[model samples]
Target: MTESNTITCEKFLPHHPAAVWKALTDPDLHARWWAAGDIRPVVGHRFTLDMGNFGSQPCEVTEVHDQRILAYRFAETTLNTTITWTLNPEGEGTRLVLTHTDFDLDSPMGRQAYDGMGRGWPHVLDRLEGVLGETPGFDEEP
Candidate 1:
């Protein structure tokens, strides 16, 4: 485990950065691939996505830099994590970067959390990619 770790997931989407950003920020669009519905990107706004018996995580959107970055605080932590999306224009597509950082991953509890995120992010991102192309996918199923 390492402190201040970064897990970056990249994808090439055949769409505009604004469109992708919309999907990342808009509640309706975000719910399609990040939770069990109910998500928004307004700063200081708190929302929850049902995780069944695993408990729902209430998250707050702390900061948003338009199409550049989105940061949020999870659960009861005073510390906040960020997901930076750098949209690089590459020919007829856009290169999307999803970076999650600002968490201590060296401790036992932190390690467990980081491990879970490490496994979860791929599937989440995959669903995101799928939804970008098709209209029949979800991060946690509909």
Candidate 2:
């Protein structure tokens, strides 16, 4: 049974907000965790995330708040969803909150994607944490 169309998750990384922010904005680091793309933290920056078998999805940066918040339009012509990543400084780490919303669950395609991504996001975030862990000097501050 499909519960909800949105995929929301929170990951507590032992890295500072600055590092987490870089991981999200930097394409190389972003690809290490998620899809490969030329993503930047500048609003209006358009990019594409190669989802392998899922094809290339067009994205446009809609909002950015330094290392605090990054929001963008994902899969413009396909999924037409909004993916927002929020970074919050917590004690000595960053609390990363991911909100992937606007899935047209009524359609089979949307349902499939929603279900698949719902399970996939946690693993993606795990990889992200792994990347940060292996970084030469990550989470060394804050």
TM-score of each: 0.75, 0.95
Can you list the residue pairs that collide in candidate 1?
none
Where model 2 places Cα greater than 4 Å from the true spot, the runs are 1-3
Candidate 2 — what's its lDDT?
0.93
Clashing pairs in 2: none
Q: What is the lDDT of candidate 1?
A: 0.68
- Residue-level lDDT tens digits of model 1 in 1-142: 5345777778887776666776787776777777664556678878775556556777777787776666676543422455566677566567887787765665676666677877788888788877777743322212
RMSD of each: 5.2, 1.8
TM-score for candidate 2:
0.95
Please report the candidate that would top lDDT against the real structure: 2
Error of 1 at 17 (Å): 1.1
lDDT of 1 at 55: 66
